[model samples]
Target: MKTTAKILNGLLILFLLVSCEKDELESTDPNLLNSANSEASENFNNGMIKSYSSDVVIQWNELLSQSIDNRLPQPAEVKIYVMVTLAMHDALNNVVPKYETYALDNSEVDASDITKKNIHTIADAAVSKAARDMMAQVFPPSTATADALLNSILSNIEDSDLKTRGIAIGQEATAAILQKRSGDFPLAFAGYPLYTEPGEYRSDFMPWAMANPPVWPANAVYAPNLGSLTPFGIESGDQFRDQAPFPLNSADYIKDYNEVKMLGCTSCPARTEEQTEIGAFYIENTSSFNNRVARALIVQKKLDGWEAARLIGLIEMSQMDSYIASFDGKYHFNLWRPITAVRLGDSDGIDETTGDASWTPTFTTPPTPEYPSTHSYNGGAAAAVFRAYFNTDHCDLDLISPYNLPGTTRHLSSFSQMARDNALSRIYIGYHFRNAIVVGERQGGELGKYVFENNLREIKKLK
Candidate 1:
């Protein structure tokens, strides 16, 4: 009897240990899955204005902006997108109309080894179903423009392609979008930035740049901070700029300022002396990234389509807010870019080491005042939000290019690493000082932390 009792106790202990290990390997680990469950009330704008296989998924989101510009209301944009994303992702997972992509509650813990080669194939069919259903909601031929546009937008799809199926589903989504809108054209375009033709620059841009010069600290030295109360406030721009590596009112700034104004418009291009290498990188690299996104959107399955659209929009919004904060901080500090300081090291009144001129950066320098990097802040902020979805220290995304650039590639280990790379690229390419990027990373992280801590909590409450 004593022997039997001991055996039973040992069996129970063994069972508990196995259960714990399984949970750890599966999802009991917060680091492996999403923990954000807070509800949100923000009328999901979908994007401030920003993929298929993750390429078709991209083009699909681009269409969102185009569709809205053509007359779709903000509410219509949100509804149509949400309906389609939800419907298609649902179909992909073999679920019904309302339960696609799993709710915040249903989000699963995907193991480290999860990779879907045929992910786009399944997403295509799901989106098609949603498109057809949504089109039924709109009242006119005009309402289904996205469907027509999509047909023309796609090229590589074969008869067996799921994307072709999504076009039909898109028709339904389009119609549904039209049904919900009241047809207020001007109001639809109300808050969008006023255009001054393709070539003309905004009148207010230069003024905004010139007037918002950064303010310097009283000492302008590298001593421990003077402990001013103003730093704690929300005011942006000047305070951050003063600490930047670039010197204000110097020739280096004039060169950068000129480039910012031209971005993609100037025939001269950034490669030439007139083009501050920054413009060259933007015109070159960013364009490639954008096109890649378009292709992904044009090809993804409906479920992935929804995920792609929602993610693209969400990231853009998050980035915009991040930029707003970083820019405000930069100008507030009255800092300079690294190039300016290193060039005139003696005048900087600091003991920091400066690098040689003629140093090329790994990435392009963006045209803006220095201190916190806009790219770093934006990149880091986007990464923070995405971390919840792909819970990994890094991603080895086999760097496939759908735009026919088969040879070009990169390996991203984590969202944070990607952000770090982006920030460092600026330095490698000689666009910013390392300090500016560090600050940008810090600020970007803080903004993202705020999203998870405050904004997401409010938004997820809705979830």
Candidate 2:
């Protein structure tokens, strides 16, 4: 009797572990649940059905570029990505059962009657309404333009009971998310005090080298305090901050200095024609490029609307967290950009380190202090999310840059390759050290893991 009781207890413990392990699991099986609605899900995944969420994202990408072109800062751009995607995911999650919604609590939104609704009609109305509404709030100046575009899209959807119900679901999701993010205004920390230290970022614009271009005469627009913004899944901004960059006079610093000097200079002899092109290809802003990549890959893989929505939402949330974490490292370490470091190299008292008084990067440096490159971090987070959602690193896909490289379409063998190229682009363009790229990639990958493990996982149906 004692032995039998012990056996039963052990089995109970094992069952609990298996059931609760969803948080740590990276991949979701397509057939994880077998329900009476299995055929509908299969249809959605196999491209027999259209995906409304995918359409909304592709269209929003265009408007997002316009906002950035009008000089929306990087942090603001990323926030735009997060809210729209989150709203879309929450809106459609009522009819689907795979992942948990981000801002909308299940108890708050009634999904009881939604199970019987057509996934296509529901996803269409919900994704469209949520995206249209969020854009109006985030980009007020473009609200009129956005509303017209949204109405044009909606006019195509025929009137039906399903459409009415779908629109309501979307509106509910929008209200919930908007209420949750109301305090997350972009200017929340606009006038926060800027930090400065021995090697920290400063606004003094002095020429580095005689041959280099003149210092940007205008005052630098200080990056907003992105570190304080609310994260979708992570507890705090500093949760994933990377360690500080290598010390100023270390050998590690010297090696990093020499490599960028040879390959990243405005007139670098070591940078090949193709390397320059790669750098320019990723010149598209962080939020826009990654979102474009995800959309392209989704079409290539033929994933349905719901699957595409989840993947995009997951990727954007991971990236937003990455940006916050990267900013924490940037402001915390207060490191110098390569342009500053290379120009001031002589003063550092390192015998091997030489200063190029005329040194300039291929492009102007961003205003923020440098440690981990934001572009690399975004790419790393994007790659991690794509790999986890697809359950493989080896996704054969072609990425056609919106920036029109010599060949618009760059064929890729895997998501990791795309990430590798994105990191190397910073070095090729002469803005970052190799260490920054490597560390940023690692930081992003870890953040991706945290997002997947902690948020959004397939749960058992209410069977």
RMSDs, each prediction?
15.1, 11.1
C-alpha local distance difference test of each model: 0.41, 0.73
Cα TM-score of candidate 2: 0.80
Give the winner by lDDT. 2
**Per-candidate clashes, comma-separated:** 94, 3
Error of model 1, residue 342, in angstroms: 2.5
The local distance difference test score of model 2 is 0.73
The candidate scoring highest on TM-score is 2
TM-score of 1: 0.42
Q: Which stretches of candidate 2 lie over 4 Å from their true place?
A: 1-71, 107-117, 187-198, 206-221, 404-407, 461-463
lDDT of 1 by residue, 1-463 (tens): 9999999999999999999999877775563344431111112211110123344544444544444322432223333444444333333333112122322222342212212443344345445444445433432333476556445444334555445544444444444434433342211111112223311112222212222213222212111111121211123323333344444345554444333322222232443432333223222232123223323333432334435544443444345455456656643554444443334434434333332333223333333445566667656665665675344445444344333234545555666766676665554444555556677777766665555334312223444
**Where is the poorest 10-residue window by lDDT in model 1?**
41-50
Q: Write the per-residue lDDT of candidate 2 for residues 1-463, one digit (tens) a residue.
A: 9999999999999988887786445355545545436655545433433433366656655665565532565667777777888887787776454568887765444443443335556667777788778878777776877677667767877888878887887787889988988787454222223334435555443232122223222434344467777788778878878477888767898899899988998899888998988888887677777777787787787766667777778888887888888887887777778887777778766778788989988877767777888888888888888888888998776777655464577777888998899899999888889999999988888788778777767543332
Give the worst 10-residue stretch by lDDT in candidate 2.
208-217
